[model samples]
Target: MSHDDGYGNDSGRTGDGYSTLGGTRQTRTRLPDGEGGDGYGPRRPPRSSRSLVTVVGVIVLLLAAIAFANLGGGDGDKGGTSGGSGGSKAGAAPTAATGTKPVTGKNGEIAAGFSQDQQGAQSAAANYSVALGSAEMFDKTKRDEILGNVIAPSAVGGFRKTLDQAYSATLFKNLGLNEDGTTPTGFTFISRTTPIGTKVTKSSDEQATVEVWCTGLIGLAGEGSTKPVTDGWFTITMELQWINGDWKAVTHSQKDGPAPVGSDTRASSADEIAGAVNGFGGFTYAR
Candidate 1:
């Protein structure tokens, strides 16, 4: 079963959490001034027109203040401030990259030419995670291409054999895919992984161990489909080596996640989910 490893069948446990790209917003509501009387007590006198005008003016000023704050007043720019010495706070650690540019090279649609640093290894691991967990990985030709491009030369043969066994015919059947990993005529298969963050546990000049925290959606989306699309959270640890001026995965493994509590938002319909997955393109990740 898929479990929380972001692979296998959907019969196992899956997360119900939804992804929202932005931060939480707060909405303030104003209530009636008096306690409820259930039409049993004398009706309270309405506020004077002048008092109502004052409340409206205050609200307008509050809104203007909020707008000004959003325009780089309180915490800084919407893209966030740089972590450079003059701009950042002392002893404050940054969880994301401040000013690093994304990689511009590709190896048959996979990212390539990562720098020989911790950030480069992290970016490579994150992008590799997306490739490995994508629907393309189910197709043999694309799978082989991805394995060749991302896996270290020394590990390609063994990793290819192991993944072939893992993505077996039985697993394809369980996922509502054909033996060749194609979906039924009316169904769409969805498998996408988005990295939440990455941390380098160990690093040196030529090798590093990085863990990518990710959330994924995988299933068959179609009417009457038993395995409707569902999401899961998992962590992938990659042993990366700096080879030929790029970071490549020597070996990688996955386990269940340190997932957050599920949200109360209702799941979208299968058709809606399918349409969304087809319409949205995945991102190129960098640290």
Candidate 2:
């Protein structure tokens, strides 16, 4: 995701993404009812009923896919994000450290004020990016709460409303969730972003620019989940303005991968990825 030491490009090359392109797992498929043999042929039950079920299934899948894409992306709105459409800005230097004590926060502060230190800025950018990208941000109730807690109150209303609209019944189903947001049978959906490294691009007293390089796991996890977990690397650069004291995202943007060579290991089952997401806890990072 990082614009390499010399490598470049994280510009949003969103190929025909999984959004409208996800393939469906055919459930309860019906063969043409002609030969009503015992085991070797299709039995004629009700042609109309079978057709109706197929149509319903198709409708459900379309709706679910829309919901999934909307919920999974454009959280900050496109206009507000930064970086060119080609790749990671040959942005200034990447921050090389994590966990360095912040130069601004008191020892016990959880949501501390802006830091003058580059390290602190990078940490702030990374954590804020995670919060902005989390799955909880798609659920209306929890999303509102988190926005109220982290973002400027003025943005909360718009963010909540837009996201609520995005995670509609159809969208949820398309994302492989039931209409009510529960996981579909035998599959788990992954949307985890793990930061590989961070860098402070620009830092001022009140506003800062930091970049987070992350590889995300996004796809359905489960036995029948055709969209298995796939990875996308990104460099997220946030323009953070210290608000009401603590840092908050004023704007952000993402691009596709600086994806390197693939690993040799077999991908985990949908259940495993799902279980891991359920079991793992995310960090409230600070430097």
Candidate 3:
């Protein structure tokens, strides 16, 4: 797969073959060539007007039903009731929260002091994923601080070197940032990862493997920005160890997603997106 870093003049191609602004590659649709007459030859006979109207009405009803079904769990009171068995309750509590309070301690700006249980592992994985994918990772000092806080002590040295190589000057330039990863005078650089949910694939008293399904927004948002902001889904697998009384990532890797289909919501303008990114504060995710 071509790694487009998600910014730049070459139609969103960074020198590293990845776009700093991530996006789902849109597939083009091709229309069939019609038989004769400039590809517009014989048109099909029109359906009955009444039949067409009925079909349209059914489609509208189906869409409404889908919309309502999606809203079912939004109400706090309706979220986790015991619906009858036989799969009726399945959607009622899909991954109910463990009810543990989020970590309030901070190691510099990163969340710290996660519990050593499965819930703690999931929480640590989710929070670490966000910190690792944030725009601060582009700055060397902040990146070092983040890695030092989140990565296991033994792994930090090697991982820091590897990440330094990954976030190269070329990649920064492609992202429309300076060599030091600072945004230009009139631009806002955004890179954020929000974990949808986390699962412990394997766990033990001392170690855990957690998967964080996440959606990320990345790009340069400004007037005349070549790479418009976009979002993409991905999963991060973290191998965590209970070291020094907390869950720390020993190793982690990312893979392109179990992404949902794109929504039909209209895209926001660059200024609107820039404003939102700057205005909104991220969550301290707990599971």
Each model's C-alpha lDDT? 0.52, 0.41, 0.52
Between candidates 2 and 3, the one scoring higher on TM-score is 3
- Compared with the true structure, what per-residue lDDT tens digits does model 2 show for residues 143-221? 5565565444443444343334444565455455677756676666555566667765545445555667766554566
Clashes of each: 0, 19, 11
Q: Estimate TM-scores for all models.
A: 0.68, 0.61, 0.69
lDDT of 3 by residue, 1-287 (tens): 00122111111112211112122111111111110011111221232222222221221121111110000101111232212221111121234587778888888877888876667777888888777667786677987888789866766665554445445554566556788768888888777778888776655556666667887776677878754455666665666767888887665544456878666565677788888999999988776
Stretches of candidate 2 above 4 Å error?
Answer: 1-91, 102-116
RMSD of each: 20.2, 14.8, 16.9
Task: Give lDDT: candidate 2, residue 73.
Answer: 10
